[model samples]
Structures are given as C-alpha cells and as structure tokens.
Target: MNAPTGKELEQARSSAQENHRALHRRISRLSDDAIDLILRDARSHYAWKDQPIADSVLHELYDITINGPTSMNTLPARFVFVKTPEGKARLAKSLKPQNVPKMMGAPVTAIIAHDMDFWKELPFLFPHEDRRHLFDGNPEYCADTAYRNGTLQGAYFMIAARALGLDVGAMSGFSNAIVDEEFFAGTTLKSNFLCNIGYADETALFQKLPRFPFDKVCSFA
Candidate 1:
C-alpha cells in the first residue's frame, strides 16, 4: 500500500475531530430519544436500484466492519459476497419465498458466517491470556461463542453499510444447513444471516413498523 498523502491525513483529522465528542460519549449517558434516532437511521431498505457496488467500496465496507465489538475480540465473523449470478442462484435455493424476491432483486447478498476455528486465532486476538484453552475440548462453549459473536459482527456489517450511505435489508428467513453445505464446504465457518445491499428503492418501502415503548421493556433500580 502507498503512504498516505498530506491532503488525505488532513481530511481524516478534520472528520475525526468533528465527531470526537460523540465518539467518546458513553452509551449509558445517551438518552433513549437519541438512541432511537441512531437505531431508526440504521433501518434496512427493502428494494434496491439497478446499480452495482464497486469492488473498492466492498473493501472499505469490510475494513469498517472488523472494528465492531466481540467477546475477547475473537473476531470470528467471515463474510461471503454473492455478486455472480451462479452464486446468487445457489444461495436463492435456501431463501424462504418471502425473502427470495427482494434478495434476488438486490445487487449483492452478504453471507455472514462464523468460524468455528476462531479459537485458534484467540492467541493473537486476546494475547493477555491463552483464551484458546477455554475453548479447547469444550464444544458447547465454542459453539455459543461463535454464534453470539458472529451475530454481533453481522449487525456491525449492516451498520457499516449504513454509515457508508448504502441501504441494507438483513433477512433471517433462510436455511442454515443448506447455506453452510453449499457455500462453506470443508470450512468451519457457518452462516449467520443474509444482508442484501444496494441503493434503496424508496417506492417499494412499506409503512414503518411499530415498536414497543421503553417503560414496558426496561426497569430502574
């Protein structure tokens, strides 16, 4: 990679400084209304335009995604990008009827998978202790770690897409076994979810769905 130019560094510094306060603020201090705005702004987009996501843009997306939280920074998530017609066709076989139409229409589908062998890399990730020892021979613990952290990483991928001004539709109505066997053959990585990504088709958006209020979902000591 080439060295960063003065102009690029300056731009990065300016952008960093502008969001410094918000970036450093604690999550607990954020009001429910503000949190709602952030969550609402990160909503999935159903329909998409005919444009294609460039390879360079995909790289940026991955770069941003790896920074999300994970248990002991295990970093178990692995992504499979379906941009070819053949790949999409294979993935389509696993999708439920309701998800097929929207997914098939999108430009790309990201298959988020979890690496069962992620513990092997825990030494590099959590160097303070040999956390790998916690997972060795403990199949149930390993499985739970992969599934939970993989799901969290998948959410980060969606937010990264949103941060980059791209629209996303994350769907869970799909077959995990079929997806795993077909796409991740011989690998420990297993499918978590499918996220369709592209520019939004605003005309196809349905009415906003209702959500439960805080009082019913929270309690104070």
Candidate 2:
C-alpha cells in the first residue's frame, strides 16, 4: 500500500493510457437496459420499505461515490447518514414539513454537505500540482468550487445508489442554516442537499416526470 514513486507513477500513467486506448478501440457502452436502471427507469422515491440499511452498505456507497471526479480532486463533499430515530427527528426539524415523512420513511437519509475549507486537502488530493494555496483568502472561489463539485458528487450518489439496487429521493427543501446549526456546528461543512436512501415502497411511488428533450436543452454549436 506504499505510494507509487517516480518510476512507478510513470508506469501507472502509461498503463492507464494503454487501457484508455483499448477502451477507445472497443468503445464499450452500457446496455440500454442498464441505462434505464440507472437513469431512465429510476424514480425519486418518496416512501421506503421498513427494511434497514447497514453501515457497511453506507461505507460501500461512499467508496463508490468518491471515485467520481471533482474539481482539482478536492473531494469537498462530506456526508452525515441520519438513520437513528433520534437523528431522524433532529434532521426533520431542518426539512420542509412535506419532506419530513418522506425522510422518516427511508431507513437512512444522507446529508450531503461541502466543506468551505476543503482546499486544505488539495495538496494531498491533487499532488501532481501544488493547488493547495489557490483558494486561500478567497471566499467566492471556495464557495463556488465546493458547491459545484459537491453537487456533482451528489448526483453520482443517486446514480450509484440505483446501480446498487437502492432507491433515492434527493431534495433541497431543507433549511440549510438549521441543518448546519444542528448537525454541522463547529465545523466548516455546509449542507448542500439531502438524499433519502433505502428500498422503496413501490406503491407509494408517483409517476416519473418528464424531462427536456435533447434538442430543446442542447445545441450542436
């Protein structure tokens, strides 16, 4: 588990390039059914089955989530899995009234948050370049990078959960100030959104909503 040195790093990079070349030659793609499972068919669940999620599952979810890319590899997102009745009760105070029951029904609700001081880890995360000092004394840069990348990670969370046969209901209707005060006090972490994860109560699911067509939302340019 030692860190790769100069020669080792070069070899790794070459191996990666070779792998990418192989992939390009093959042009592997996800099956349409697999796509449906992760994005098309997946619905934002509102109710969950009584089954409980284990700590190991949460750990596995996080392990998959961090593998998704981030700005300068900052990896700003932090999570708080609220699963206990007491924790859920506390979290309920920060959510909109309508969302409280949805969160409660799910066995685990993840508080997806970002750290304003995440730049401190840049030196380690983005080791190829010394990016650690780039955000120093810059509130705007810190806030923007953390939020943008953290939100991307949040999206990855839902997709990864679906791939793992878990239902997800993500929302931003919570009071950020309240959640921060209650769950992230004395820390630099700021709440981005909440995602409830568990097996869905399919009978309680609503019809999937429509999305903007590719033509309407995109352009050839």
Candidate 3:
C-alpha cells in the first residue's frame, strides 16, 4: 500500500477519533462477536511493511493502555521501545533461536516490563493507609502484582493496536534474565513479554489455530 499523504493521514486520524468516541460510549456493551474478533482474530502477527509505526501512533497507544486497571491502582508496567539498531541488538540476545528472525525482522518491538520496586510509591498509587508496608516484608506480593498488572497492560497494548488498525505479534519465548540484564540493567523492571507492532502480511499467515469449545472452557458458576 502507498504511504498516506499529509491530508490522507489527518483524515484517517479524524476517522479513528470518531470511532474511539463511539466505542467509548458503549464500553461495556460490545457484542459477543465483536469481543471475539478482538480476542480470537487477534494473532501473533510477524511480517511487517517497510513503513514505520510512527511515534505519534505509539503515543496514542500509551494513552489508550494506561486506562486499564490494577489492584489498588499500582500501575507498575514499564515499556521499552526497541526501535534503534543498538536496542534491537540488545533484545536479540535474549530471544529464543526460533524467535530471533522474527524479532530482528519486525519494524519495532516493545519490551513490556514490571517494576519490582513499584510499591515504593504506594503512597501515590495505593494511598489507602501505609499499603507500601503490605509489600515491604513480602517480595512475592510485588512479584505477583507486577506479573498480573504487566500482563493486563500487555493485553491492552494488543487491543489498542488493533483498535488503531495495526497488528501485533506478542511472544514470551525469550530469556527474561538476559533481557533484564542487557536492556534494563540495574533497574527494578523485569521483562514480561515482547510485542512486535506493525501492519500485517496476511499472505504469510499459517492456518488458524483451533480454540477450545466454550462448554469446556467456561462455566456459569
């Protein structure tokens, strides 16, 4: 597809804004099929175009994802944008042998991470009593909160990408320790997952994977 012209890009943004407004109005009322499309049709996309996923789009994506929830609102997810060659090289070291090609080939990959010391600011994020003390003696609480909230934010990233007509390939097949040491250095952040963001190449998709039957996967109780 041709690159969108200035006018064309603005028009697209206007259209997207309108759609966002419409979706926001009925946030909890999405049809079952629409919700399924968001979950089921969402795939771990790999192939990408030569065109970049612009900085403006990344900003919009963050604006959408930070709206997601967390226990006591302790939003601990941190994102590292791996766009530069040096940065990509760092990420490449941790990727599994099978994931190397895709990670290297994608236009951009986001390193979703969790901050181990996130509770330090509980006075700001939790604010109800000295909740920071709740996590001080128990490191597992920090681990659990980071893992759960980071995963939720990662899922939000995928949904926000789809909402903006972009595709993502999210993967966990990487060495977390290597990533933490190489990219995050001395920071408290632990790597959670990698998400490749860009337009799709449908021709490269394999056959769709099967899903478990609802009867087997869900129960009213």
Candidate 4:
C-alpha cells in the first residue's frame, strides 16, 4: 500500500473529526453486538492471520483511545508500534521464549510506556488548571501518577483496537529493562508492557478461560 500523503492525511483527519462529532450526538447505550465486540467476545489472541494493518487504522485507534479520561488530563503514555522486521527482532530480545512466537506473529507489537516527565506537559495537556505544580520536587508523586495513568491509557488502547475490529494480546512476559534499553534508551520513558495487535487466528485459540463470577468479585458500596 502507498503511504498517505500530507494532504490526504489532513483530509482524513478532517473526516475523522466530523465522524467523532456525529458519534457524540448518539445518547443511547451500545447494543449487545457492540458489547460483544468490545469485551465479551474479545479474547487475548496468541496467534494471528497473515494480514497487515494500515497506519491509518492505528491513527484512528489512538484518536479514540486518547478520549479516555486521565488524572488531571495528564496523558502520560507513549506507544511504539513495531512493524518492521528489525523492530520486531529488537523487541523479541525482551520477550520470554514462550511469548516470542506470538509476538513475532503479530502485525504490530506496541510498546506501551510511561513518560516519567509527563508532568512537564501539563501546561498544554491540562491548561485549565495548574496541576503540574502538584508534582513539583516530588519524584514519588510523579512516578505514581505517570505509571497509574499510563496503564489506564494502555488498557484504553486495547479496547480501542477491539472497537476497530482488531484483536489484541497484552503480555508482561518480557524484561522491561531490555525493552527500555533497546527502544527508549536515554529517554524518561519506562516500558510498562507490550501488546500484540492484528487479526487473530481463532482456530489456534483454546476455549475461553473462566472468570470469577460477579457475585464472587463485586459488592454494592
């Protein structure tokens, strides 16, 4: 596929903005199919079909994911989409042997990371208030806020992928130190986890794993 030109991308962005506006006008809750697509039927895929994901789709996924709320509107997460052979090779160095096959099979392996200096962006990301001051001279507070909010964004990314008819498999079976050194060297970004995104090979999946019943895990406050 040809790369999108600057003009084409701008046009796409304009169309996407209008589409998002239209979505806001719908006040009703999602139907059962939507529920299934986003969660109920979604599985952590360990294998993938031999297909490719376009960059435009990734852009749309990110656009949706960022709309999720974060503490003080501090969007602390950064993502590296590994699609090239070299990129995937470097990423494989961090994965456990059991996880390597699945990661390499994925069309894109996203390195979800948190910027330790995310507070510095608050002047623009959260311009309505001076929340950056809340982290001044406090390394622990900065670390906590970044990691917490970054993880939320990573989860949001997976949901957004599912909403776009893509499958995701999130994994922690990797060495963060290796990932950080390979992909984010000399930066404040710290790797949180890696997630594979693509069309899944359903035939390779085992039956859905059991989950705790609502009654077992939930209670009215």
lDDT of each: 0.86, 0.90, 0.84, 0.92
lDDT at 123, model 4: 79
Q: Which candidate tops lDDT? A: 4
Off by over 4 Å in 4: 1-25
Residue-level lDDT of model 3, residues 38-108, one tens digit each, is 67566767677777888999999999988888887888899988988998888898988889877777788
lDDT per residue, candidate 4, 79-124, as tens digits?
A: 9999999999999999999999999999999999999999998878
Clashing pairs in 3: none
Taking the tens digit of each residue's C-alpha lDDT, what string does model 1 give over 1-221?
Answer: 23345898689778888787667663436566554533664566778899999988899999999988899999999999898999999999999988888898899999999999899987678765666778999989999999999999998888778777788899999999999989998988899999999888889877788888999898999
Lowest lDDT 10-residue stretch of candidate 3: 121-130
lDDT of 1 at 123: 64
| lDDT tens per residue, model 2, 120-168 | 9766787677766679988999999999999999999889988888999
Off by over 4 Å in 1: 1-38
TM-score of each: 0.83, 0.93, 0.83, 0.88
Pairs in steric clash, model 4? none
Candidates in order: C-alpha RMSD to true structure: 7.1, 2.2, 10.5, 7.7
- For residue 18, give model 4's deviation from the true position in Å: 16
Instruction: Judge candidate 2 at residue 60 and give its lDDT.
Output: 91
